[model samples]
Target: METHRIEELERKIQEYETIISEMSAPIIPSIVPQTILIPITGLIRAERFDKIRGNVLNFIHNKDIETAIIDLTDISGERIEDVCLEEIGRELHELASSISLMGVKALFVGMNPELVKRMVLDGIKLESQSFSTFQAALKYLMKQKGLEFRKISE
Candidate 1:
């Protein structure tokens, strides 16, 4: 009788161990979206410019990224000083020209008031371009890529 009780207890323990092991196993999910999002961070320094320029060119070359958002809202208002603003204007103009040359689309994001003023005063020359909020930029890129646009009715 004692031997039978010990065997029954061991069987129960083995069942519990199996259950615990199954519960501890990691659960892998199936579906994931393929959109890539890159954030532009920090001041408009040359290093930052180089990194961004390299990434942009690579993405353009590989045809992986559909849209690149160059957010400017996080930039310090003081950083938009005359010198930095001039640098930004030149970089943006060059970026736009580069994208045009490569036949790729670049969507700039987060245009602060100071940057806008500087662009106007300095004549940065991004006038004949398209830019918008992050969501709008994504939608525009999708539309440009021949994806179906969900029409909005008036």
Candidate 2:
């Protein structure tokens, strides 16, 4: 009947939304061994934070990841206020703590300076090692592994 079709469509839409949400937070393994990078974009709501935490935990639990780089470069400071920034900072701190407990070093990269200042002004302390860019984090990891990169000319 019409009602049954509508219900099926609704269920499908919900399923798609869930899939999209999960895809938004991808845990990508870096070229360096035992390093995983998670690039976060868009507005990070409370629900999204939970999803991010769960996904990162689940993925790292199965992999031999010694370092996790959480990149927040794509998020703009103009889009979020100080209050929201504080909340997101707190969530990031929690995520970092959890990852540390699992024996993984969590490095936060690409944080907005303004937001970071605001968080600091609010007395929010971030325990994770932070870098201004993903490249910096990668370089640090490579150094830790005693690996060097040479530019190859085409």
Candidate 3:
């Protein structure tokens, strides 16, 4: 009887973990139409990237999204190892390619210099549109939609 109780608790724990992991990577629709952003947070892990890839692809598949901004501000060079970097880089490239094949453009934002340096040293060249910040990416998207930000009198 005690074993059965423990097993049920384990199952519930696993379910909660799955939910939390799913929440960690969300595809957020932008203020502009047909645009979405995926803000990647927390430690750089292949598992998290896997979830992001699946979620982005699936969400864009059914939706009429034209652009996807992948925010990488939370990843740092010091926190991730070479092997993990390689996997994440490869997956990122593949995810872009997949999104392209689906007729959606993918953009990267907030890539730290250290991570880029490590990727370059590792010979991982990921090709695609990348911005230094979310605002930059959003600016580009807005321009594409024929919108611009102007200073307004207070």
TM-score for candidate 2, residues paired by index: 0.91
Instruction: Write down the TM-score for model 3.
Output: 0.88
Best by lDDT: 2
How many backbone overlaps does candidate 1 show?
A: 0
What TM-score would each prediction reach against the true structure? 0.58, 0.91, 0.88
Find the 10 residues in a row with the least total lDDT in model 3.
77-86
Give the Å error, residue 40, model 2: 0.4
- In terms of lDDT, model 2 sits at 0.86
Clash pairs, candidate 1, are none
lDDT of 1 by residue, 47-140 (tens): 4554466555656675543344555556656654344776777777776566556665455666777777887898777732445466666676
Q: Give the CA lDDT, 0 to 100, for residue 124 in model 2.
A: 87
Most accurate candidate by TM-score: 2
Q: Rate the local accuracy (lDDT) of all candidates.
A: 0.57, 0.86, 0.81
Per-residue lDDT tens digits of candidate 2, residues 74-109? 877654534377787788889999999899999999
> Compared with the true structure, what per-residue lDDT tens digits does model 3 show for residues 26-66?
77889878998888776666666667777788888877989
How many pairs of residues collide in each model? 0, 0, 0
Off by over 4 Å in 3: 78-83, 150-154
Question: Which residue runs does candidate 1 get wrong by more than 4 Å?
Answer: 1-37, 64-67, 79-83, 143-154
